[model samples]
Target chain A: MSFITGKNLSCIRGMKYVYGKVDFTVDAGEILVVVGKNGCGKTSLLKTIAGFLKPSSGQITISCADDLQSLDIIHYIGTSSSLKKQLTVRENLTFWSKMLDSDADNIDKAIKSFGLDEMSNSQISYLSSGQIKRCSLARLLLAERKIWILDEPETALDNDSLNRFIDIVTNHVKNNGIAIIASHRPDIWPDNKKLLEIG
Target chain B: MGAFLAILMRDLRSDLRNRAQFVMIPVFYILAVILFPLGIGPETGTLSLIAPGILVVSSLFASLLALEKLFSSDISDGSFESIILCPVPISVIMAGKITAHWILTGLPLALITPFLAIMLGLSFEIALFSSLIILLITIILSLIGAMIASLVINTGKGSVLLALLSFPLFIPVLIFAAGAIDLAIIGGIGNSIAPILFLCSLTSIALPVVPIICAAIIKWQVR
Candidate 1:
């Protein structure tokens, strides 16, 4: 199974500490919820794991069951939806699938799985913020990565959309996928997860 | 190859849908080129003599209008982060973006150069010949713009900063491209080969190199 572990991990930006001296581990089929006060480096820590930022000290390593490179098996969804507003839902998803070199079949499946069939042809700019968030989340299914790094994924999501998100993450973990989520609402997360608190 | 085409097509599709923005580049190019003749007087000899430089400089300014959006939009929308983190090589991804920028701004501008060239008292043959040089110079401008755009992505005044940074880098391209066209107009078509070959060599070097540099700068910007 795949696992990620951080030892005495610290993140510093602009000569100031965001988080420091922390250790955590999560394995396949597990979720790690990173919680903290605003500006506490929760996002920085997630970015560090995603290889977007270099940690000021310590190390975070990913060991997957397969021989794939760590970056190849990891997906990071940040606070911004990353969906192009000018394009329709299907267009955005299709672009991601192609960029990731994923199977073309997943395009329609992702649209259907996210309940975006009716809105598939609607431009993202016309959709509600919640709808836009759903379109971005559909991107997760476009690739077959082992690790998912999500930062504030629940923002702008409605109750129904949040439930859908939970289901997707649950299904993902059930299939031996690892999810590392950074969120303000730890209570809304699935029961099967570990918590890493930051300040 | 799939990832590369995907990024390129995605950008092209987006631009096509935004017709106003898509049309503005060439419209601006045309307007700017037309202004030179009006201000310089309709003297054919003077206009013909300076047509190459006028076309090159005006197109450069027109390109600046679209450069800010090249990387800053992706950064602001957070699409840039996802784009870089994708499975494809960063260079390939950036190459797609640079190509897309050229298509949206450069290609269209080149297509309309004949009309603009005629307005400046250039013959159809010389206009057609100069369009080729214009196309090459635009490609180089797009490459240089991509790098400068990525570098200034997070700055408060990205467009202003982009203009300042890209202006200096664009000087060499302007010289060769305009010089080539000048030779074609003043001398014979065959006489322009030296500068045309120089422009080609510059494009050859930039085609492969700029994307790598852009990739590194983008990673650094996000980091």
Candidate 2:
């Protein structure tokens, strides 16, 4: 089993401290929902664990059976869709598949699971914001990374898409994936998740 | 290798789909070159004398047109964050991007140079040789531009800032490339070989180093 542990995690942005003395642990098949008010450094905390930002103090470590480094196992998805508007949905996913050296079969699986099969050939520019978000999330399945560092992944998603997303994350956890989600609506996630509140 | 090629093809395909932006650089290059001859009175001797400088300077500006968005689009759209987090080395990704930029902006500038040179009254042999030198210089420009583009990705007026930061880096290459072509036109191919070799050496050095610098800068920007 794999797990992530953050001990007294404090982050600083510029001269100001973002969040201080935050501690949390998330094992395989569990979700860590980070919640707080606006400007609570929720994004900064997630980015810190995702390796995008340096922690001013404390340490965050990932322990897994595999020999892969912490970066190799983490899949960090920020607020932006990160898809090319000029390319079709399939084209974007295919590019990620090759870039990550993932199994080609996962592309079709991801498209189907994310309900993107119907618009698979449509350019990203033509898709709705919710649809674009789905395309970006489909990337998580394109590779078998163990940790999912998601920041407000439900922002533009509609109700049906949101339900679908929760299902996907549930399924991912069921399959032994770790999801560290930063969301304002933590109720959407199932119970049995650790809540870390920061501001 | 797979990641590099994937990024390259993805960029190429994206540029192909947006043909307007793809065509703008070469069109800009041609227009810039055409203006020089018109303003200089079309005197063959004057045109020939200034052709090397004209081609190099225009190509430099034309190449700059695309460098502004080289990494900014990716950064703004979030593709860069995703790409950087991938298992492949960031240098590989940067190489792919630089190659794509060169193909879209630099390669066209180099390819069309010979015709522009001949139009400015240089011999076919000299034009052919000058195009090769221009090609090498364009490669180096793309490398330098990619590095600077990544550095200024988060700054306001990035295009202007990019040009400012990259111009000094580009000047040395510009001097050598134009000097080689001028030498070729004035004293024949043999006299231009030294500067040509110098351009080649510059490209070889920049090819491996620029990408690493770009990767590091990009990482820093996101941080």
Candidate 2 residues A89-171, lDDT tens each?
Answer: 99999998997889999999999989999999999999998899999999999999888999999988899989999998998
lDDT of 2 by residue, B110-220 (tens): 899899999998999988987898788889889988888888888878988988898999889889989998888778899988898888888889898999998888878
lDDT over C-alpha atoms for residue B41 of model 2 = 91
Instruction: Give native contacts recovered, as a fraction, per prediction.
Output: 0.78, 0.81
- RMSD each, Å: 1.9, 1.8
Per-residue lDDT of candidate 1, residues B1-223 (tens digit): 8888988999899888898989999999999998987899999999999999999999999988999888876787888778766768888889998999899999998999988898888999999988888898999899888989988988888988898888988998889888988888878789899998988898999999999999889988888
lDDT of 2: 0.89
| Deviation from native of the Cα of residue A13 in model 1, angstroms | 1.1
What candidate 2 gets wrong by more than 4 Å, as runs, is A65-70
TM-score of each model, paired residue for residue: 0.96, 0.96
